[model samples]
Target: MTRKTVRIAMNGVTGRMGYRQHLVRSILALREQGGLDLGDGTVLWPEPVLVGRREHALRELADRHGLDQANVSTDVDAVLADDSIDIFFDAAMTSTREDLLKKAIAAGKHIYTEKPSATSLDGALELARLANAAGIKHGVVQDKIFLPGLLKLKRLIDGGFFGRILSVRGEFGYWVFEGDWQEAQRPSWNYRAEDGGGIVVDMFPHWEYVLHELFGRVKSVTALAATHIPQRWDEQSKPYDATADDAAYGIFELESGAIAQINSSWAVRVNRDELVEFQVDGTEGSAVAGLRNCRAQHRSATPKPVWNPDIPVTESFREQWQEVPDNGEFDNGFKVQWELFLRHVALDEPYHWDLLAGARGVQLAELGLKSSAEGRRYDVPELTL
Candidate 1:
């Protein structure tokens, strides 16, 4: 019956993902719900102190959310130096995240951040080592694992739905409009390699964790990365060279002998039910999972079709799959993880997804890019602290 308030220093609220997912949907949403119940007769309340580079944007966000203006500051150092702040959360640009996280660890604050934890594998490992040495609770954002569709898929896996998983195929991405005619949906930096922008670096980290958590740890990767759009207009309506790869096609070998092929592109148009989808095939059954829905076809119900080039085919192939039911309410993936991290910090609860896991993700990305450049498959070496 007691309330415990934990102050969180929220950095990079000016960015799209930080503003929408981390701030509004996660932290503010929890605040509106009267905090999280800790199951120990204690309500873990979160108080957010906005930290960013722009004073105007911070003030505007605070005003929009009806938050106290006094809690918003452009000085991240001053915020991190505050002893009252229990956690420092970052959703900033990948280029600037490492230094900020290191400073937070030095300040003795629990740190949580978005991945690719650093621009390189070495930097990611350094963050992990520093956080462990500092004895502070640290975490990296692995939000997709907590998604509802993935949850249902995991349930099926646990229930022996997919006996002896065979392979996984994932398709993710959408066409980002060139900024000349229509303003690009994504920031200009996403297409510039100099600014820590590239489809391979941006998404390979996600694929690493997703494949590892669901199927198996990736053992090797053969990839081909391309910049489909060579030129694009920036936010200022000026043309610039798009040096980064906008699309990547990769084949991954998993430790469990399962093969995973994934295609990530920002130039392809959507042809699936969701923006992203994964089709997992096994010896006993197969399932396709999107961001919110999962459908499965068991061996018993699967239809057999004959290959014919001359005859008209009508098998109702899509109808063969049965929809997975949502037996429980599913919250936003970001919000769920926030609550878990809050519990871990407040009650010393166990959390296995730390900065080391993030380093593994970054390692996959680096290897993937290398594989693409060399036109050869590369083995994934095991990383240790």
Candidate 2:
């Protein structure tokens, strides 16, 4: 079996999502597993060059992860200019991603990035056009679809268990500590509108792909957004006005005539089984999927509740649902997508999640914001490039 090493120029590995998900959990884990087998008796090995603005941070990260110090660099331009790097992956701050991707495309590097590829739909489409024109393979992360719970849900959908889908409801939120007392878990830039930070921009991309994959294309969106926490302390412990919307409530109309209501917030406290949960109600059954767990109830097993406002209900409503069994052990979602992208690049495999899909995500987010601004449902136009 022949083994080929694919050198990856990884930008923004120092950030939280970049460090943990992309670097530690995904790329490094793939390396530890002896790379990915291509089914054709060839193994594709991923060799990542960690790029960041801080030399000290990069050096420390490399040391902590047991990566070679020679692989760490502060000079992004120099790394992009390196002809040996076949792929350019970015998980950088959203505001700066477009320029970096443009440079990578110019350098003839294949592109892959975390969602909301660009803040604006136009910029995202431009990136797609450039990558397509340049004939470089490209992809955007749609990790949620590969999640174990969602996979189970997909299985149910394919099995005709749901019978005709009716609607999907998603609840996603967790309290984010304002930097006043406790140290904020998320970056300070997430709450600043000028920096391309907002719950709508950060999360609508996930919703877009999830809805499109499981249900259908989102036809229109009616949304309401707000900056619930007006003032917050920054990373430096100095007070600053939170200009971005911390929460967004959206109602989406699917092409299949299914209604999807998704609530995304950073200020709400968690009361559900997981940090995020999606409930799908169909004609024959209903299912709720969390991050790792999924439960369902068929029409036969569903309880018929009588309307009795004066009496206390004795039925165990939650216990009636049966847990969905794990048919097999599932890998990390991010790692799974990473492997697919690698295979797509190495084997010339068909990959649907490309720059155009990323642009669609951006389009949804832009239209969602427009819906909120106009206080009316905004039709989501299909993006073609």
Candidate 3:
């Protein structure tokens, strides 16, 4: 039995992801519960040092989280120079990520970052390369794969429940109003192009887990994006110019000959919170997974259809895709990945979701952007060794 106490230096503790990853999830799951249960006596406990931009803000954050043993400060230099901290976590916005990460690597620390590794692909590749050379463990927050519902989908696939997967269709979208006037569903930066925010960069990291793990590596992609709502009202009744794409439609060609069609948008009105789901079709059967349900249909399934053109009709087969509740913790998204990462760090076990996995996500986003700009499909490189 090995008990490892890892010292963590949290970067970007002032922002949304920072507060959640650094304060809430990390503190609750790792510091309090001693990481996720790996079915043995391996405990990953984090002794965290909180860092932020402002003194008052950082101190308050540290106090609120009851991080008594934490060294809370606004000094980035001080945090980087500390020898005791084992890992440096960056959940900061994409714009400041490159410079901050470069500094962290120089300090000889393992790294954990949020999606869209850097604002650009070159920076992301270089960051991964540097970490590899430094001989330190690095990973990004790829929380989607561990989602219990999605995990069920993964289990079914690995269990051969979906025989010979043919294609994956992903529907991810929701309606977000400007929180300024009403309650803004998403932050203002999410809609601003200057903030390095968009459907492609923010959401593709999640897709990276789905597309690569389930269907196979994406061979190529072509995409189109649009800013459906150009002007939105802010909290102060000010009109804010929205430049980022509110909707994106794309097609991914996978090496396994399984094509994926994905859509991400902020303009769609749906009765789901952060609507994220996918339907996987196979030769012998098909399956659909959502936040609430995961179900499969075998060869014994029957086909149902409604033949009316003007009325709201429900197909009898639609009810076949039902909900399944897992017998484990089903809390926030960050918490799921938080415990998984700590378990990996604590035990030094084989964690397949490494830094390279995160970089592959950046590659997809980069190529998607290129495809939109060039008006042609681009090839996705083979990454896993």
Candidate 4:
């Protein structure tokens, strides 16, 4: 038996997302059971060559993880040039993604980068082409597909529980902290359009999975987007202009003749969760999954509509649903995808979450942007895998 180990390099591991995605998230996942739980070689762990601009941050990470001189550095090129490093993982901000990913592919390392893979449609397509041409494994972080709630829904759909699925309605939104007085926070880059930001691009990948998983591919989409909030304060108490779309309403048409409507927002009042809430209807049955519960209604007892708002209603339609239990522990969404990447590289396994899927997502955002700009419907391009 041959000894198995795949050396890996991380690019942009210093920024907020980089720190979480690369250092805390990916590093925790690479271990057997996370943090110092290095078992007796049960799972294949990749040695990391951390590359970032911040020396102090890198040094701190190295010290915290005991990486020291073994596999840590400030030079990205050095890490890419090393023959031992088999995988290149990128959790860099969206603006810096394309060039770095292309560089890694040129260096002949398998790649896993965060979405939207690139800010533009052509950029993502080109990256996919490069990865395909080079014959290196490439995957984008599509954490939503692996979500436990959605996974259960996938099983139900595959089991033919929802026959000839018709439409999907998704409501996903909540107010995110703008690093105001509380200074508690979300990534500021997300609210800034120039830095490759916005709710449409940031969250469409999640909708892509649910829509593609249940109905099929998207043929076209029409959207309306807005910049509801204009100013927000950063950590320094300096006000920054918000340029990205804060809220988006989109209608999707799947290739399989099904339709979908999605509402993604940053200014919505939280009545339910900000999570991806779904209501899927079909010929045989219907399923509804959200933060609090997952419910189903068969064709036998489909709604006929009772029209008395003042009347005493016994069976509340909303109260009929029951909570979906936690299928997996509360791991960061980043960590779930990170582990899959490790398995993909070390085990030589097939990872379904690829760059093409990410490109489709980019296309969706692009269409949303177009619809918002042109003030009309935009036909989504099919996934060019």
Candidate 5:
């Protein structure tokens, strides 16, 4: 089989998500597995060029991964200028992504990036326009849809298990420790408004795609945002005003006429089996899916509970639901998307999750924040390049 190396200039490998998920689990894992077979008589090998501001951190990461230090560079411009680099992948801070992507597009490289592609809808739209104008293949990270639980949920949808879907309820969050006693689980910038950080800006993209891809396009949204913790310590044990919203409660109206209510918060403690969970109820069946597992209850199997104020309930409601079995081995969601994008770049395959789709996600986040600010429902408009 003929082998081809796809050089990926990956920026922001120092951040937690960038380092762990994208770099380690996805790109490096692909390298470890001896590359992806492209179905034709060819195998696509991924060669990662780590790019970021901190040269030492990049070098250290490269060393840890047994990668050549010569592939690590602090100069993104030089990396972009390299004609050999086929794709430019960004997992950098959201505020800085648009400009970097613009450069990569200008340098004639394919694009793949993490979402909130920009801080605003217009900026995101601009990137989409430029990439389309340049005729460069592009994609955004929509990792949640490839998750095991969500995949199971999608399977049920395809099998008509939900029969006339009715509504979806999602709960996502965990208490991020303030940097005072224990170092914060997340970066301090996540709580700062100026740094393009907030739960709405960060998570609404995930929700937008999940709702749009699985159910139907979100037609309208009514949301309320809050700064549950007004004060928090930074990385250096210095306290700062936590300006960004830590929690967001949203009610979304889907085009399919199903209502989705989601509660996203960083101040809440975990009570469920997973960090994030969605309970979808329909006419024929209902399913509750977490990050890894999914459980469903058919309308015929659903237990009826009598409302009794004075008497104790006897039915075991949780026990009635059947667990969704994994018929296939689930790989890391990030890695799966990387392989798909690589295939798209190498084989001219159809990939719908382009920069336009990412722009829609940014649009949702922008409108969600606006809805919260105005204390009113906002209609989601269709976006075009």
Candidate 6:
């Protein structure tokens, strides 16, 4: 069996998502597993070259992660100029993604990046056009669909368990620290408007693809957003006015006549089973899917409750739902997608989650912000090549 080693230039590997999800959990894990089996007596190995702005931090991260220090560099332009790098993966700040991707495409490298490919819809679409014109393979991260709970939900939908899909309710969020009394978990840039920050820009893309892939395409959106926390402490303990919206309430109408209501907030306290949950109701059944768990109640098992405020009701409503079993072992969602992209690049396989799909995500985020600004419903236009 022949083994092909593909060198990947991974920028912004020092960031939280880049370091943990892309580098360690996905790439390093793939390397540890002896690369990916190509199902034809061949394997594809990924060699990640970590790139960042700081030399000291980059070297430290490389040493800590057991990566070759020689492979770590602070010079992005120099790395992009390297002909040996076949893929350019970005998990950098959203504002800088477009320029970086353009350079990568110019250097004749395939591209893969985290969601909200660009801050604006035009920029995202331009990136798609540029990549297509350059003839390089490209993709955007849509990790939520690969999640176990969502996969189970997809299975249920494919099996026609839900006779006629009606509505979807998504609850996502938790209280984020302001960095005054307690150290903030997220980066300070996430709360600043000058940077690409806001719950609408950050999460609406996720909602777009999830709604599109599971139920149907989102037709229109009516959204309300607010900066619930006005002031927040920065990384250096300096107070700064948070101009970005921390919470958003949106109502989306799907093409299939399904209504999806999503509430995204960083200020709300968690009262659900997971950090995020989606409860889907259909004519024949209802199911609630968390990050890792899913529970459903079919029409045969569903209980009809009669409203009687005069007396205490004695029905175990939550207990009536049945837990969905994990039929097989589930791998990390990010890792799964990474394998697929690698296969797509090496084997010339068909990959639907291309740059166009990423542009669609950015379009949703842009429209969502517009709806919030105008205080009116905005129709989502179809994105074409």
Q: Positional deviation of 233 in candidate 4, in angstroms? A: 1.3
Q: Could you tell me the TM-score of candidate 5? A: 0.99
Q: Write the per-residue lDDT of candidate 4 for residues 1-385, one digit (tens) a residue.
A: 2335667787777777777765666675556353222234544655677887777777788788777566667778888888888989887778888988988999999998878899898999899999999988888877766656666677678889888988988888877766666562566777899998898888776677668766788888888988888887766777899898888898988998888998998887777643667888899988877643466677876656678989787776765544445565645556767776766665556787888888888888888888889999878766674
Off by over 4 Å in 3: 1-4, 34-42, 233-238, 271-274, 304-315, 322-333
lDDT tens per residue, model 1, 176-221: 9989999999999999999889999999999999999988789999
For candidate 2, write residues 163-244 as lDDT tens digits: 9899999999999999899988898899999998999999999999999999989999999999999988988999999999
lDDT against the true structure, each candidate: 0.94, 0.94, 0.76, 0.77, 0.94, 0.92
Better of 1 and 4 by TM-score: 1
On residues 147-234, what C-alpha lDDT tens digit does candidate 5 reach at each position?
9999999999999999999999999999999888888899999999998889999999999999999999999999999999999999
What lDDT score is found at residue 87 in candidate 4? 88
lDDT of 1 at 159: 95
Tens digits of per-residue lDDT for model 6, 356-375: 99888888888888898898
Candidate 3 vs 4: which has more TM-score: 3
Cα-based TM-score, every candidate: 0.99, 0.99, 0.89, 0.88, 0.99, 0.99
Q: Per-residue lDDT for 350 in model 4? A: 76
* Candidate 1, poorest ten consecutive residues by summed lDDT: 311-320
RMSD of 2: 0.8
Which sections of candidate 2 miss by over 4 Å?
Answer: none
Model 3 clash tally, residue pairs: 3
lDDT of 2: 0.94
Model 3 agreement with the true structure over 91-205: per-residue lDDT tens digits:
7678888788888889998888887778776778788888888877778887777666687787778888767878998889888886555776666777788988788888776
Cα RMSD of all models vs. native, in order, equals: 0.9, 0.8, 2.8, 3.3, 0.8, 0.8
Of the two candidates 4 and 6, the one with more favorable TM-score, higher being better, is 6
Give candidate 1's TM-score.
Answer: 0.99
- Collision pairs in model 2: none
